[model samples]
Target: MSADNAAVNFSELVNKNKQTLARLKESPRLLLHRRDGEDLVLTTAAKAEQDQTVVSAASRMLSAMARREPGSMELLLDILPEAFPWVRFLPEPDVHAFAVELVDTMRAADSIGNNASVAQMLTAWQHTAEVHSDPVLLAALTQDHGTDYGPVRHP
Candidate 1:
């Protein structure tokens, strides 16, 4: 196939994936996870306005993550791992360590703010997490529509 055709296919794939994720985005179950050894509890049904706020914040964090923008690390922390309950089955130590390292790397990248480096870091993160994570869980995390899943930077 020509390069142009490949690009079109890639774009179509991205759109299809986004649409699939959008369909999966609604009514995500909230799973509790301990933060600092204490359970961080949140419920989407608390109030309509609150739910909207949560969704908006999550969307912004994801955009930042995708763009590799500055301050993305802090935004990432705002999202708890429990937010993506699907990963609950994975060993906490592995996920927690990965989250911590991700935050650290994002923080370090902020000092220099190199888009290429940030992109590389995000890719490495995805690969590392995929290696340690269950295939089904990883797919849900990457391909599903949920705040807990972070951003799907795949094409």
Candidate 2:
């Protein structure tokens, strides 16, 4: 199914399963219950730790990108193929150039009161282009799953 239709169907399902959804929304880390009525909090701790790790990794990646570190482009390229499968066929130097251009654009955009990250800015730009230029958008207001082909990973 198209993403937009899937989203509508998913929203309908969520509305139908409000009770279960409420529990999930209330405590995403609520993973288990003990026999003595006490709830295990380890899961919550683990989740928080994982989140912090991701943030830390992202911070390091962004710093490297900003500094134009030697290995930074390689790291970025590694994730690009997974996120944008077409990048798998692109030459390493080309990918590096593209990443550098993207990061520079993101930095410039952030300086002008638009503080979105590189990924966010790229996605927004592509979305805008798809909306304005893609013939599919004219035929049907379908969702563009540009980033849905693969897993998003820390650079």
Candidate 3:
């Protein structure tokens, strides 16, 4: 299949998964923390640490919104990329600025619809940036499952 077709198919899948998408229409704070406490515990300690940092950052942003403190918003944006590596993939110049703007918009006292544009953009950016040029395991998994795939790891 052509790259264009593949891109279209991916887009269709994403659209279909809208309901399943967690960050599509909610604040990062609202979407980042899962209700499944056990699932969080199952993640590696390092990953859980990173997740906790992101959660703390989100909570700070939420507090800033509640107090309408511009400085807190600025601080939140400045630390966001460090707290969540995925934010680093956002397009340049606007990445930091847009993060603060998104939180402010999403948490506006009078706002109706959830504003998750930043989260969606961050998710898309991470997805596009992290995808390997050659996903060896994915290619192998597509073949017959019983086929000898050799050792799972290389020294």
For each candidate, what is the lDDT? Answer: 0.49, 0.54, 0.49
Q: Model 2, range 1-155, lDDT digits (tens) per residue?
A: 22221121233333665543344345544333345564433224566767656655555556557577777667876777676655544445656766666666655654453435666756654554445455666446666656566777889
Sort the candidates on lDDT, descending order.
Answer: 2, 3, 1
Evaluated against the true structure, the overall lDDT of model 1 is: 0.49
Pairs clashing within candidate 2: none
For each candidate in turn, give its C-alpha RMSD to the true structure in angstroms. Answer: 20.0, 15.2, 19.9
Question: Which pairs of residues clash in candidate 1, taking residues 3 or more apart in a chain or in different chains?
Answer: none
> 1-155, model 3: which lDDT tens digit per residue?
22221121233334654543433233222122234342111223555567656655664567566457757556767777786676665555556555655555445421443335546755664664344223674465456777686778856
Off by over 4 Å in 1: 1-78, 82-90, 133-155
Candidate 3 off by > 4 Å: 1-70, 108-121, 125-155
- Predicted model with the maximum lDDT: 2
Question: lDDT at 149 for candidate 2?
Answer: 60
